[model samples]
Target: MDDETSSHIDDTDRRTLVNAQGAVQVVRTTSESVDTRLQQLLDRANQQETEMTDVADAVSELSATIEEIAASAEQVENRSQTAAARAEEGDEAARQATERMDNIHGQMSDVRTELQSLLDRIDEIESALSGITRIAEQTNMLALNASIEAARADNSDGFAVVADEIEALAAESQEYADEIDAVLSDLRSAADSTDSELDAALVEVEQSSDEVERALDKLGAVADAIEETATDVTAVSEATDEQARVSQSVMDRCTTAAERATEMTTTVDAIDQFRAEQTAMLEEIDDALTEATPALSVTDIDRIPTGLDPLDEATDGGLLLGGQSVIQHDSPVVDVVATLCASALSAGYAVSVTPPEAMSRQDLSEGLASHGSSLSDALATDRLFVLDMFDEWTSERNIFDMRASSLADVNRETATRRDKPLLIVGNIAGEIALLGEEQARQARYENDSTVFNPADTVCNVVDERTVDESFGAFYAGAADQVLELTGDGPNRELTLRSSPTGSAPPRPLPATSTPVSPRGD
Candidate 1:
C-alpha cells in the first residue's frame, strides 16, 4: 500500500474503534434501564395476582351467604303458608261453634216458653181444685142441716141414715179436692223452677253465641292477616331466589375474572422470563462488545469522569470538555450538582448558579463533603464559583448575586479568571421549584445567552416535577445530552440520553454501589 493510503487506513481504524466503544457503552446503559423497569413490572404483576385471588375468595363466600339466605327464605315461606292454613281452619271452627251456639240459644228459648205454659196450666188446676173444695164444704153443710132436721122431727130410720151418708160423701169430696190442690201446687212450683232454669240457660246460650261470633270475626281477621303474610313471605322467597341467581352469575363472573387474573399472572411470568433472557443476551453482547475493541478504551481519551461510576460509563467516560449536560430529576438535584462540581474541581474550576431557597451554600458544601471534597477549600483556592440565581450582581464583595448579570457574562468572566476548563452548573429547575416559572424562564434565557466555549463544560439541573413535559422536552432538546434520574431512595434509577434530538432510547446510568441522594440529605 502507498504511505498516504496506509496513514488514512490507520486513522479510519482508530475512529471506528472510538465509535464502537461508544456504542458498547450505550448498549450496556440501555439494557440496565430495561432490566430495572422490567423487574418493577414483574413485582407489580405479582401483587395484582395475589389481590385478584383474594377477591375471588371473597366472592365465593358472598355466594355461599346468598344461598343460605335463599334457603332460609324458603323455610319462612313454607311456615307462613302453614300458619295461613291453620288460621283458616280455626276461623271455620269458630264459625261453626257460633252457629251451634245460636241453635242452642233458640232451643233454650222454646223450652223456656213451654215451661212457662205448663206453669200457667198448673195454676189453673189449682183454681179448679179450690172450687171443688168449696163445693164439697157446702154439700157437707147442707147434709148436716138435713141430719139435724130429721133428728128434730124424730123421724128415725131412713132419713137420718140418708143424711149421714150425704155427710160422708161430702167429706170424701173435700179430701179429694185438698189432695188435687196440693198436687197442683207442687206441679206449679216445679214448673216455675224449670222455667227459671230454662231462662238462665237461654241467657247463657245467647252470651255464648255472641262470644263465638266475636271469636269467629277475630279468627277471620287473623286468617286474612296470615294469608297476607304468606303471600309476602312467598314474594320474599322469590326475591331471595333471584338474588341468589344474580349472586351465582356474579360468582361465575368472578370465577372467570379469577381465571383471567391467573392467566395474566402466568403471562407476566412468561414476560419476566423473556426479560431475563433478554437481559442475559444483553450482558453477553456487552461482554462481546467489550472484548471486540479492547484496544480502544475510554480511559485513553481526555474526558471528565463524574465520580459516579454509573454516570461516567453512561457518558462513555465522562462529560465532553465543552458539552452541556442536562440533569433532569423528579426531586432536587443539589446532590447531583455537588457531585458534578466535586469531580470538576479535581481537573479544573467549577461554577454553580444556585438559588438560596433551593440550596444554600452550606447545603452545597455538605453535599460536596459527602463526596470527600471541600467546597470552602475549592473557593479558597479560587477553583469554585457560586452565584445567586435570583439576586442582582453588584460589586466584587457581592459577586454571588447575578439577577442583573447573565450566564454569558459569567461564562466570559470565568474563562478570563482561569485558563483551566470550567464546569458550569445551573439550577433552572431549582429556581422553578423555589421561585416561579417566570424566573426559571429568565434563567433559561440567560443560560441560552452563553456561547459554548470549548474551554468549559456546562451542566444544568432541572426538576421534572416543577415543569411540564413539553418544557422538559424543550430544555432537553437544547442540551447536548440528558442525565435523567427517576424514582426515590432504594428504587431510584438514572438514565442517560445523548441524542441531539433526544430521539435515542435512554440508557441506564453506570451502576453504583451506593446511590447519591437526590436532595443531598
Candidate 2:
C-alpha cells in the first residue's frame, strides 16, 4: 500500500503518472507507425533496387548490342569509304579504258584501211605480173617457132643459140609471175587474219569497258550505303552513351534512397526523427523518378547499294537521288531483281515494286525469299511497297495494297517523281504496250515528257527465245542504253549493244547470277 501510494503520490501525482503511461502508449503507436513507414519505404526501395538491377542488366545487354552495332557500323563505314575511293578510281579507270578502247578501234580501223591499201597496190603489181607472163608465153612460143624454122631452113647452129636465149628469158619471166601469185595469196591470208583479230580485240575492249562501267556504278552505290550505315552506327553510339549516363543517375538516386532508408531504420526507436526522414526519402524518390529524361530518336538513312555491278552502274550509283536508267534483258532474272531490291533496302533506300501480273504471288514470295532477311524486314517496315496489279497478292505479312484500276492512274503515280528511285521489274515496256493503244500512247507521251519520273531505274526481263525482236528494238531506241541478255542459268551472256554516251561497239558483259541465298553464296 505504501509503495503504491508513493508511486501514485497524491491524486495529482496519480494523474501525472497515468498521463505518463498514456504518453508511453502514444509513443509506442508512433513508433509502430514509424516502423511501418520505414518498412514500407524499405520495401519500396528494395523493389526499386530489383528494378534497378533489371535495368542494369537490360542496359548491359543493350550496351553490348550497341557495341556490336557500333562495330558493324564502323566496319561498314570503313568499307564504304574504301568502296567510294575504289569506285572513284574505277570510274577514272573506266573512262581511260573507254578512251583506250576508242583508240584501239581507231588504230584497228587504220590498220584495216592500210591493209586494204596494200592489197590495192598488190592488185596493181599482179596486173603487171600478168602482163609479163603473157609476154613470156609469147616469147617462148616465138622461140620454139624460130628454132623449128631454123631447122627447116637447115641454118640450125646460129638460130639455136638465139632460140636458147629466148627460151631462158621466157622461163625466168614465168618463174617471176608464179612467185608474185604466191606472195599475193600469202598477203591476202595474213590481212584476213589481222582483220579478224582486230575485230575480236575491239569486241573484247568494248566488253571490258562495259564491265568497268558496271563496277564503278556498283562501287559508288556501296560507298553511299557505307556512309549511311556509319552515320546510323554513330547515332546508336551516342544513344548508348546517353543511356549509360541516365542509368548512372538512376543508380545514384537508388543509393541515396537506400541511405535514407538506413537512417530511417536506425531511428525507428525515435519516431520524431523517423517521420522527418521518411518524408524526405519519399520526396527524393518522387523527384528522381520524375526528373529522369528520355533519349532522342535516330533518323532514317539515304542512297542504298545495288549489289549488281552492272545494274548499279547503269542506274548510276544504286538508283540514287538523281539519274535514270532502263534495262531490257532476254532472261527471267527474278533473282537478280530481288537481290538488287534487297541490296537497296539494306543500304537504306525505300523501294516499291510493281510485279509482273503474270507472276503468281506464291512464286514471287518464294523468289523474294531466295534473297534473304533484308527483304523480309523491308516488307515488315513498309519500306518495300508492292503495288498489286491483279488483286491477287500474297506476302509474309499484310502490306499496303495499291489497287489502281487503270494503267493511266498507275502511270500518273509512276510519273510523280520522288527523292529515291522506283524499280519497275518484269517486262515493263512490253506491259506498257499491252495496256492498249490508248494507254500505250499515254505511256509514250510520259516517256517523252520532261515531267517523266517513273523510276530512277527501270528493268525489264524477257527470255531470249521468246523476246520479240520489235520489242528489243523499241527499248533500244527509247532507252539511254540497252543490255541484251542471252543464254540462261549461272553463265548467261549479256551484250551491251548501245549506249548513247559511249562510242564503243557491242561488248559482252560479265556473267552474273543471283546467289541461291540473299546473303550471297
Candidate 3:
C-alpha cells in the first residue's frame, strides 16, 4: 500500500471514532433526562396514592361527624315534638277554662238580675206600709170625732164605746205598719249588700275570663311555634342523615380510589425498576465510552445542615452523611424532627420514619410549609419520603406484622435509593411502642449493622419521658452524635452532648420550636 493511502484510511477511522463518542455522550445526556422525568412521574404517582388515602380518611371522619349531627338533630326533633304536643294540650285546657269562666259570668249576671228584682219588691213593700199608716191615722181621727158627738148628745154610750174600739183597732194597725216598715228596711239593706257583692263577683269573673282568653292566645302561639320548631328539627335531622349517607358514599369512593392509587403506585414501582435497569445499561455503556475519553467529574458533599443554625454550626455543617445520630429530648421530638427534615431536604432527598399516630401528615406538611416548601410537592418530586410504621394496636398496615429487623433494611434501601445525600429521621419512642422495649432494643442493636448506608444521615429521636435511662444511654453510646433538647416552648435549648469530632456547641432553639399542633387544631 502507498503511504498517502494508509494516512487517509487512518484519518477516516479517527473521524468515525470521534462521531461515535459524540453520539454516546448525547445518548447518555438524553437517558439521564429521561430518567429524571420518569422519577418525577413515579413520585407523582406515589403522591397521588398518599392523597387518595388521606381523602378516604377525611371522608370517614366527615361521615362520623354527620352521623353525630343526625343523632343530635333527632333528639332535638323528639324534644320539640313533645313540647309542641304539650303546648297544644295546654291551649285546649286554657280554652276549656275560658269557656267555664264565661258560664260563671252568665250565672253571675242572672243572680244580679234577681237581686235587683228583690230590691224593687222591698221598695213596693215600703210604699204599702206608708199607706197603712195613713189609713190608721184617718181612722183614729174619725173615732175622736165620734167621741165628741157622743159627749155632746149626752146618754149615747153605745156610739162612744164603738168609737173607742175603732181607735184601738187603728192603733193596732199603726203598730203593725211600723213593724212591717222596720222589717222592710232590714230586707232592703240586705238586698243592697247582696247586689254589691254580685257586682264585685261579676267584675272578678270578667277579669279572669279576659286573662284566660289572653292565656289561650299565648298558648296557641306557643303551640304553633313549637310545631314549627319540631318540623324544622325534623328537616335538619333528615338533612343530616342525607349528609351522612353522602359522606359515606364519598368515603367508599375514596377508598376505591385509594386502592386504585395503590395499584398505580405498584405499577410505577415496576416502571422505576425498569428505569433502573435501563440506567444501569446506560451507565455500562458510558463506562465503556469513558475508557476512550475523559471521565465526567462529580462533587460529593459529606454533611448536610439540620435547618437549625446552631445545630448546623455545632455538628460542623449538620450531620455526617454516613453517621447515625441520637436525639434525646424532654421537649417535643416532633419539632426537632421537623427542623432536621426541612434542613436536610434543602440539600438533598430525605426519608422520615415515624408511627402513623405520632405526627400527622398535615403537621409535617405545615412544618415543611413553614420552611417555604410544600410537602405534597416535595413528595411528588421525590425529594421527600415518609414511611408510616404502624403497630398491632393501630388500624393501619402494621409494620410489626413482619420481622422487626426487616424495617432496618427497608429504611436503608429507601435512604440509599437516590445518588444524593439522604437524611433519615426516626422516632425511637414510636418504634418502641410498636415493638416492645426488648424487641426494640434488639432492633436498635441490629439497626447499627444494617440500617445505614455510606451516604445516609440518620437521626433518631427519643422522648425522655417515654424510655428508661438504660435504653436512652444505649442509643446515645451507639450513635456518632448525641443531641439533647431541654426546657419547653420558647425556652427550649438544643445541645450537642457528644460529637464524632467534638466541635459543635450548644445553641438556643427558636420560639417556633414550640409544638407543631395537628392540622385540624
Provide C-alpha RMSD values for all models, in order. 10.5, 45.6, 23.4
What residue pairs are clashing in model 2? Answer: 371-518
Q: What is the lDDT of candidate 2?
A: 0.54
Query: Which candidate comes out best when scored by TM-score?
Result: 1
For residues 389-494, write the lDDT of model 1, one tens digit per residue.
6452334422555556665566566555654556677666545654566555554445434443444556767666666554455456445567888765545566
Task: Give the lDDT of residue 79 in candidate 2.
Answer: 66
- Candidate 3 lDDT, tens digit per residue, 401-505? 233435666655554554455566776766777677777667654554455444555677878887765466556644557899888767788899876467455
- Candidate-wise lDDT, in order: 0.64, 0.54, 0.70
The deviation in Å at residue 331 for candidate 2 is 86
Most lDDT-accurate candidate: 3
lDDT, candidate 2, at 63: 61
TM-scores for all predictions: 0.56, 0.37, 0.51
List the candidate 3 regions with Cα displacement exceeding 4 Å: 1-30, 286-521
Query: Candidate 1 lDDT (Cα, whole model)?
Result: 0.64
